[model samples]
Target chain A: MFEWNAYLIIIAAVAGLFFATAVAALVWAVKNGQFSNLEQGARSIFDAEEPEGIQQDFFPGEADEQRAKLEKERRPS
Target chain B: MSPLLSFFSSIDPKARPGIPVKVQLSEIDESMRTPSILFLSAAVCWLVIGSFFALVASIKLHSPDFLANVEWLTFGRARSAHLNAMAFGWANNAIFAVSLWIMARLCKTAVRHGGLLIIAGIFWNIGVTIGVIGILTGGLTSVEWLEMPPQVAPILAFSYILIGVWGVIAFRFRQLGHVYVSQWYILAALFWFPWLYIIAQTMIFIEPARGTVQAITNWWFAHNVLGLWFTPVGLGAIYYFLPKVLGRPIYSYYLSVLGFWSLALFYNWAGVHHLIGGPIPVWLISAGIVASVMMVIPVIVTAINHHFTAVGNARATWASPTLRFIVFGAMSYTLASLFGSGMALRDVNVVTHFTQFTVGHAHHGVYAFFTMVMYGSIYFMMPRMLNREWPSAALIKTHFWCCAIGIGIMLVGLHVGGWIQGMMMNELTPDGNPKYTFLEVVHALVPWLFSRSVSGVLLTIGHIAFFVHFFWMLAGPKISRYREGPTLLLDSIRGEGKAG
Candidate 1:
């Protein structure tokens, strides 16, 4: 049988309950949109691309000229 | 010229075949390049210097008389320099470069005025170089990681502020929907580091606190710097790469948040666990022990998420060097954190404290978890940044195996030696006379010392190979056209199957 000091046991129980609540709250946050689009947001502070992913911004910006340069770089005559 | 020649000459087809080749050249923000390059070059220099110190320290451990009389190359100084270089120069700079790239690419914006970042890199390197020299010249402050002389500390402080300001500005301009898990960690780490750094510097050095208060603050700062600053960036990179390489969404967003918040709340308090059983306050020790145990929640959640995400795609381990190193590092993070929590228990700490077990444990965290992930970042980066394939795949493999085995042997040896040392230290005669002397205990661990030397050599070999391969790739070579070179191991393997 566990030797339980009443006060100490009560403290331990309270602490455990607090931690469990905290854990539950964190899980909820992750399920919501907290973890999504992390990298995009970190860098988006610099440019005003369409709020969508990098793929979406390609058509509107300097994508055309960059595409030409890439095409030129790849052609091996 | 043959039509093939003409076709080759006109080879600017503008896109990677099959993959989206229409990458905007402007997307490769020129502003970010110089800062990244500066950080990388400085990191390489620090790696070399750190490795050299490691060689000396390992040799000293094996052969105490090897440099018995040399004041500069003593175990104390050499070990400090080695750790400083690895932390400040290698790991910190690598994180900075990757952070810059990730910020640029994710935001789809060039760094606004990257001049400050470059200056930060220069000042950071200068501070570290001076700090390392100061350590060798007997000017070390004798702090564990902050052994830098007073002269260099302020310089480093200034550099951190400058570098951190750029990140703050970048965070402000962040685009919506791009605010992913990795970005949160990066932003938090950037803010957390300077606050932690400045407060500790002020409390510990600028206005010296009372005797044990400094030690308390030191523990708080060191633990948080590792947990809050370095761990965040490494985890951020893993978050990015895991999804990118697996081509899958993370297993659960819920788990990611659970992992992050739990870490933020618990890890800062757990550093004092290192001082358990020492003369620290009883309440502080209790708090640290509780926090350490609570860390398991985050570790377990993160591990499950990573493992589930990585399931079925285990083949990527062999195919993509980046994934292999990063995923392995992610696994090590679990291992290190778990080991740390266990060691925090009073029973375990009794056996592991003041022994090689602690050393082994720290390496598992620093090298296996952090450095391995950095390697993955670099592997992913070099090809994209340089617009070329790695010069030789064989060298990459060699570097991987060497680092892996070196750390493995080092940890195993340390564990055994530490256990023996702990047990022997525990043994005392009935009359209060010790059964075995300290020297005797030292003699008992000689074999482990030799093993450590062997492991150090293996690690050195890996570092040297990595350094060479990186330089070679940076120095581009002329090659024939029409050879649509595959970038990743997975791609090459798939290509081989097609050819067959």
Candidate 2:
């Protein structure tokens, strides 16, 4: 019966350790500026911007002439 | 056009040409082609195999004498095999393929160690095979989720370590300055799963905790397998594909952060609810119930984030196969989770515990929510990986409807029948005697079990269609001039800026 108490203590200690680790992680994240730029983080998925002046390949079935025409219409005079 | 009309039209983003994200995504998909294909194909094979086992098990429930003589096909071994196959073989493998691809793309890094990933995947499947076979051959451990014998656990763990480390390595070499919320969830899951698995194995099997503590450890591990392991990966995929398919970001970054952290903190503790009526202390059960209720914060926050993001985009969501299935899964996640919290209450748990209601809830979480989202992710992924449009929209529609309807019937039949069974089991006569015999209650469940078998057949059809269509796309030629863009359910939605 006393062994039950020992097992309980061990479980409690493990739970405490998990709680402390989580708090530590939260603190480290805050300290390291992980939460500073929320909007930028949201936008980060689209960070793969191709360089200007590179001729991008047209999607399948899209004519090159049509793409060039669209590009010309977008360019300033 | 009139000035007023032009003003309103200019404010609508959907009226504009779609963003040029697909080209960039294709590059990432190209880099991950080999490993992602291997994982996906293996996962589909397991899905088919698991569905077979599931059907057999469901049949035996209604007709016990059908295959009673076959040692390997007995209820105990077959059911355990089905659970492990679906959980580890199918779910883990699909997560490896989809989540790793998402991690690589979100980090802006081409997968560096593709060969290592394939090798790890092969070994992981091998381990699961050995484990399943061991269970059939009289080596069953009787542990709920850890039914895989001890001899195979080490190999499984080692293979998982190899696969999991690759995600961390990819993040270490990431090119982005800002880590997306999806990355945090995926990365955390990759770390948490092995820790939970190892600790549970040590306590339950190796050191062998005394008496009811073993039951405590078992429930803790089993529930965490669903909560920590499967839930995070499923949510990560939802966070990624939801935004990408809608061509927008998640509605509120603050809400996402709250949802992620609250889930991480509360879910691990809620596992104790499975032991609510057991021999454990009352305070422990109360803690589990509290944490289970606290889960509402994350569930509601995530539901709102996903819901608001899809608002006004119903047309596109309905038109795209990926978004359609994912939205179904997202809604299921919210409903199933809230229902789960309610089930954890002592009053409700009294009737639901040790009944088929719990089984219905488990399927709701694992199948309707997690597996549906995975199917959606695969639909989006296969096109990008193969650089071709799906050969048949009819097949995709067939797969979706079959699974949706099948799981729907199963959940309804199980819950309604289980409730009757539970209530009857709890009833007593005025003279302090039982109202119904145990066998009588068992006899009542036969009809519901038969309905479950019918649902199983529908799901099997869905699985076959999915696998056939997937392989057809793989072996077919790339997209040509005639079959140009990504396939959409609606013709008008084609060539729009939707990610496959």
Instruction: Provide the TM-score for each candidate, comma-separated.
Output: 0.81, 0.88
Q: In candidate 2, how many Å is residue B308 off? A: 1.2
* lDDT tens readout by residue for model 2, B1-500: 99888755543333447522233555778879998999899999999999999999999999998788999989999999999999989999999998899898887666655787889889999999999898788788988999989888888889899899878877776766677889988988898889888878887887777777778878888998888888888899888887776556778978898898888777778989999989998898899899999999999999999999888666556666787788889999999999999999999999998888999999999999999999999987876677677777788889999999999999998988888889889889999898999999999989998999999999999999999998888898864333344422232133222212
- Which parts of model 1 have CA positions greater than 4 angstroms off? A1-77, B1-31, B430-433, B478-500
- Judged by whole-model lDDT over C-alpha atoms, candidate 1 comes out at 0.72
> Quick one: best DockQ, which candidate?
2
Scored by TM-score, the top model is: 2
Q: Model 1, chain B: what is the TM-score?
A: 0.90
Report, to 2 decimal places, the DockQ of model 2.
Answer: 0.14
- List model 1 lDDT by residue over B1-500, tens digit each: 79877644332323125433223323444456678778876777677778889889978876889887999989999998898888888988988888767665654444655776787888898898898899899998866778878678789888988887666665555444446667667866886777677767776788765556567677777877778888888888887767665445677756775677777656767778878888767887899899899999988998898888787655444456777788889999999989989999999999899998898888888888988998887877665555456767688888889999998999899888989988888888999887889999989988998898999989999988988887776676744111233233333343334323
Reference interface contacts recovered per candidate: 0.06, 0.20
Error of 1 at B1 (Å): 58
Chain B TM-score for each model? Answer: 0.90, 0.92
